[model samples]
Target: MGVKIGLTGGIGSGKSTVAGFWQEAGAALIDTDAIARQLSGPDGAAMAAIAAEFGSTMLTPDGALNRSAMRELAFSDATAKQRLEAILHPMIGARARCQAEAAQAAGMQWIVFDVPLLVESGHWRERVDRVLVLDCSEQTQMARVSARPGWTSSSAASVLAAQASRAQRRACADAVIYNDGLDLAALREHVLTLCAQWRRCK
Candidate 1:
């Protein structure tokens, strides 16, 4: 297998941007968040289970998971969140492993498993060769997320509060990219440098 990197960061920490840089540099990127989104879309693998657990009210008119409604429920109810994870995590893990195996078979030098909750999940550390964390301050996180459409400071705060703290994420990181004030070009340069380092290590 190639160098497997578990890329993670807090919400709005620009983790996706970093992952994009690595993807463009030829790393096979398997994003768990994107997979989860697909699995909750219309006719998704997790949809029937989600509907069964939360009923039709948790689904949209088109039969997709109503993310907004589900998010509200998950945040307010711990059991609801656990139930959702129970349904989705196994599916996500299986898909991710398959993708990684395919990437290794295709002769890829790097496989970047971009997971939002890499540290919180606890099991991800054993699956990946390295943990790459994108770091930024709470204020930066709030500012970035608040600028998005339909997101308020309170909403961003709540989401941030639910994720692992910056300190905890850093503790698990084999490499950290501090993106608090860096521009896109600088971030790309950082990623490029890291990619070279990972290639050398491999």
Candidate 2:
């Protein structure tokens, strides 16, 4: 119902920061990741299915999905990952679309769906009016991710390798923000400029 833009980037590429800027500018953001977090939190809507499928050991003491265990399982076992996705992806998509419809009903002009795997997700390409990619070198991504708490070079590399390549992401983008060395102010400026240009979100 509005100019629904899909904002995306790889890990540590400042995707969340850009989402924040859009939200601060009054765009209704349907953040899939945040919705996933909610679905995995204690007694969440998907928890029952997860426990039923993956066994109760996949849940923590607080009845939340044991992320570390699930992550390990997903990587080592492809079918495990597929099973998990089968449970969560539909839930996330449904919630996101519902929120989006609500945002449109509220007379909002811009609707941003912040999806990290927009390029990899087949259904997302047609769901939005535009796709925005936050472009950065893989080396920059590795360095930024490795600097985070409890992260190491090997782990960062693993995470990067698992995602869709930068080339694939760039190929799918309608616009690209090359975010290598820009400061926060410059980045904010870039987002705002795009917002102004794309502000015709009727």
Query: Which candidate number has the best lDDT?
Result: 1
At residue 142, what lDDT does model 1 achieve?
97
**Once superposed on the true structure, which residue ranges of model 2 sit more than 4 Å away at CA?**
200-202
Displacement of residue 124 (Cα, Å) in model 2 is: 0.5
**Clash count for each candidate, listed in order shown:** 0, 0
lDDT of 1 by residue, 105-182 (tens): 999988999999999888999999999999999999999999998778887888898889999999999999999889
Q: What is the TM-score of candidate 2?
A: 0.94
Q: What is the C-alpha lDDT of each candidate?
A: 0.92, 0.90
Residue pairs that clash (backbone atoms under 3 angstroms), model 1: none
Q: Candidate 2 residues 88-144, lDDT tens each?
A: 999999999999999999998889999998887789989999999998999999999
Instruction: Assess candidate 1 and give its TM-score to the true structure.
Output: 0.97
